[model samples]
Target: MKSNTPLIGILTSSKSDGSIAGNGPLFIALQKKLISLNGISFVFIPEGMEVDCINGYSYSPEENCWKKKSFPFPDLVYNRIPFRTKEQEETSQLLFSRLREKNIPFFNPCFIDKYELYQLLKTDNTLRDHLPETILVKEKNQLLAFLKRFGGIYLKPTQSSKGKGIIRVRMEGPSEILLEGINKQEIYPSFTQFWEEWNEELLKKRYAGQEEIESAEYEGKRFDFRILAHAHYDNYTLTGVGIRHSQEQEITTHIPSGGKLLPYHLFQSSEHDEFFQTIISIIGKSLSEQFGFFGEFTIDAGVSKSGRYYIYEVNSKPMSFDEVDIEERKIENLCRLFLQLINAYPQEKNA
Candidate 1:
């Protein structure tokens, strides 16, 4: 049933039984956009399926829903695996290897490792100052030393998203420390006691210690910026910047962590805009050079009252933004990338 339409394969997660696990809405939106562009899109789980075909879901325009179907290998594959652990699985790696073996074009192929990306970006002189002071939190003394230097710091899981597993640590006094998590706060008499409870948690997953950005307040609330960018015609373009405001002392300004979204126009500093644009462009190109092709990425950044900006994170698989305009532009830009890739790697009858 495959025809001449450009076929796009979205690589996402699935349950053990091969049912799609997440990103239902995003898949649908992407399908609709591709349809509008005279293309076809389908969601496929890379769980060691048939070598020549994959079991996936495709939109049924007549039924207004997605229907499970067997599809030929797509012209282009867009990696959207939801979790880092899943992306690191042996099966996923095998699938990626197969794609490369067949000479298929894949963009944003995997989730970017946080500490690894930090190490890469810090090597660039232009981006070094814009990054926060960060280190792998492996020992109690290292944490204590960082706290002493910054007075306040944040501990973040290297692979998590949506502000999960983020912690804020501040020196309550010489004898005590204040620890803030997404939903709980506790005061420990000393770093020794805190490490006793947190060391095991850190051992459970990789975590990074970063200096807290004393960001400028909007309406007495802390805020940060999400600068969304995409690769278009071999160059990175800033799609838009979003502002998220913290809710009642929240450790992170992520919407899922109870942060409120603010209009981007509220903070109109031309200097800030230019800074984000220049830095994001640098980051996009750097990532492209370091790691193969990347179609999209979002930079989580904060601005201090002193006008200093810091990049907290860069995510390869960014979540859907709440802003309607950002969503529309993202879809449009993504469709364009798909078209470019489709032309670049024309589909082979057997591949």
Candidate 2:
């Protein structure tokens, strides 16, 4: 049967040294499966350098660049633009806007649009409840209030990812607080100390702007859930659930902070089994209907000592697969979702 499956163009950042980012081993398995499917072709578009022309026109330049005027307009775009500086974000938004105007189907249609996410949350009470006590604060006063209320809070840039610009503030007592970077080991005894040290470090090396942190503690060990979800055609699937447990004195469960990933089932003690299951089901349903999320995305969630689960952040674009065999089920689920998407759009041609 003749098909019209669109060519899927994946746009993602290249390695700092300009090499093509290899699909991780887990994704390679899925890629192999996708290639054998009836309709669907994935083409990688590596990040390219933007150069200013002599006439003030900036263009993306490559060694063997095809003129933009002659290149094929992609029918489907799998956007994986990693977080960048504010200026880079603006440029990326402009590029994405152009693609949207051209009517290209995007995996995450507009993740960069924070207003859309906010709007979705506002309308859905269930989803909103599951999220952390998040507030968009423009001033330090609002941040201070949040910190006071949460005791120890996490501050993160609304659009940042991969644990960048994530700061953890621990309330030691009434007047004392400890602050640490999401990835770094050093700790500051107070906010003032953190600011001075952070600023000094920033002067020595560039970092993203400050972020509003979310704070929560669990067990004697602080941890967070990395739940992988996907939307395929009209169905939403929870592909995997893993908990990242902080190692040593780290404040975050981010892998860069020496955290280890454990299966979600580990939380299923005889006492909390039903409770855990209920929360997972509730979260899955709420996010699927609210976000219209398609393809793989991840959410970081934390549970307090009192058993209250709070979602820290949601990554609209999640990491491809990981090394552990435990990820096999997730890979399979993702592959199935990809196949389902292809089946739904069977008329489109593979690239």
TM-score of each candidate? Answer: 0.95, 0.68
Clashes of each: 0, 14
True-structure RMSD, every candidate: 1.7, 7.7
Superposed Cα deviation of residue 26, candidate 1 (Å):
1.5
Query: Model 1, stretches more than 4 Å misplaced?
Result: 16-18, 346-351
* Residue pairs in collision within model 1: none
Give the alpha carbon lDDT tens digit for every residue of 109-157 in model 1: 7777778889999999989998999998878887789889999999988
Count steric clashes of candidate 2: 14
Alpha-carbon deviation at 84 in model 1, angstroms: 1.7
- Estimate the overall C-alpha local distance difference test score of candidate 2: 0.52
Cα shift from native, residue 37, model 2 (Å): 2.3
lDDT of 2 by residue, 121-151 (tens): 5466655655555555444455556667767
